[model samples]
Target: MNIEDLRDKDLQPQLDELIGSLTRMWATMLDCHRQQRAIIKLVSRSYNLKISFQSESQRQAALLLSVELRNLCSNFQNWMVAQVHETSEEEEEFQETCC
Candidate 1:
């Protein structure tokens, strides 16, 4: 596709819809990340409490799960940053070519 294709009015609505969907998805992800972090904090605080876990294995499992969740959150944040950077670069290129 050429610059004209990128500037086409027919694609504008689809692009707008995609941006809206992405914005909503980002908001949902942020909410979920906040909840996950809260859970991690709660689990970490109660890590030593015998009442929190029935057995050693269960405690270990909880610790592992929390670690994995933290990693997931970190990975997601990195991915988002990368995506933003990539989009910015693409926009710049598009403008340079089209304008």
Candidate 2:
């Protein structure tokens, strides 16, 4: 599809779908981030004493916590990308059906 050949009216449905998808994604992401913060706080509190004590157990817990948080961040990123791709595919399908 040539960008120059596309009309705004013809693109409205896809645009609307994309906007709706984005709004939903944003809300979901916000909730997920909030939950992530809570989890991090819980982990931090559990390891807080360990941090000051500087024991092998504390080091292990800290390492594991960091890895878990990293994985969470990676997974969230992948999910967001997937949502975008899914929206695009849906838009394509919508266009096919309507036209």
Candidate 3:
């Protein structure tokens, strides 16, 4: 459609929602990356301990990372759901009339 034919008023909310979804998605990614680094640090510390291969703290950290990753996936799903298509009522009516 031409620029004059476009209605930014109706699109503004949808655009805002999309921006929110993107922001949430980015936050989730960063959180997961941060958790991954934490897990790596735990592993490295466990190795440095050198007393034995047994480390409850390292194990717990790994488990927590797994849970957090699962939670991140759930958050991503919510973010994706927030990006549903939105059209103005007038636009919908016009398309119906044309058809």
Candidate 4:
């Protein structure tokens, strides 16, 4: 469909749904991160107790995965914010033109 066919009012509901989904996803990600951190702590403790090779390997892998997840979440948040800002600006412009 053409841009002219797309109206902000028509898209608002979908946008709201998307925003809601993103918000929920973000909250879930935060909870997961907290759980991951807790698990990492437990693993680290396990590593410290006996210094087993497998425990150390597991701890390192967990740490790397946690960092990767954190980075992904940060990037997703930044991208989401940019998308919302851009959509708002477009809506404003559309309104101005329509009026």
Candidate 5:
């Protein structure tokens, strides 16, 4: 569709694309999470490393954690939309039977 035509389009397809893109982005972070956990285990295994939340790296960890949280929220939204769309489609089919 032309740019002018696209402006008036509904957001269903856009949202679907968003869901696909977000899934890919979230998958990339899985390796990072695994590495982080491994780091924690390695540190704990070597010395009696005291875990403290007062570090700057902990703040960075919080930021990374938030990204995963956001992805969970996005996936929930997409699931909701897909359910709604399925319901609407079923309703349309039912209406056609009344004719």
Candidate 6:
């Protein structure tokens, strides 16, 4: 129900597992993006035409979506690193206080 419950229940391992899963998922997303780009490039080269959004607004939207995805990934990485540091600090503090 609270911080004490989380600590007492020893949920760190589960949290760690979830983080690992998410990390894998993120990597897959990035791989998919790369594959999509490659496919698009291949198609465009094969056809000798630009393959892209049909309208200016659509192109802008796609650009924004890409920027957002990049920001999301950057923020997620930063958060994950901070979480690892926070967990280690908490463990150290708990050890100091309890033993």
| Number of clashes recorded per candidate | 0, 0, 0, 0, 0, 0
Q: What's the lDDT for all of these models?
A: 0.73, 0.72, 0.61, 0.67, 0.63, 0.69
**Superposition-based RMSD of candidate 6 using all C-alpha atoms, in angstroms:** 9.5
Worst 10 residues of 5 by lDDT: 43-52
TM-scores, in order shown? 0.53, 0.49, 0.41, 0.46, 0.42, 0.47
Task: Show the lowest summed lDDT stretch of 10 residues, model 4.
Answer: 44-53
Query: Which residue pairs does candidate 3 place in steric collision?
Result: none
lDDT per residue (tens digit) for residues 14-97 in model 1: 877886787677668667766766876686677566557789999899889878977876796687677667767866886797
Model 1 weakest 10-residue run by lDDT: 43-52
- The C-alpha stretches of model 4 lying farther than 4 A from their native spots are 1-54
Q: Give candidate 1's whole-model lDDT.
A: 0.73
Tens-place lDDT digits, model 6, residues 4-87: 888667787777677678667766866776676576557446643455778999989977876786676567657656766776
Candidate 1, residue 35: the lDDT equals 79
Residues 69-94, candidate 4: write the lDDT tens digits. 66765776576567667766866886
Arrange candidates by lDDT, descending.
Answer: 1, 2, 6, 4, 5, 3
Better of 1 and 5 by lDDT: 1
RMSD list, candidates in order: 5.5, 9.4, 10.6, 8.4, 12.6, 9.5
Between prediction 3 and prediction 5, the one with superior TM-score is 5
Per-residue error for 54 in candidate 4, Å, reads: 4.1
Position 81, candidate 1: lDDT: 71
Q: Which stretches of candidate 3 lie over 4 Å from their true place?
A: 1-5, 49-99
Q: Which whole-number lDDT from 0 to 100 does residue 61 have in model 2?
A: 91
Residue 92 of model 6, lDDT score: 84
Q: What's model 1's lDDT at 28?
A: 86
The prediction achieving the highest lDDT against the true structure is 1
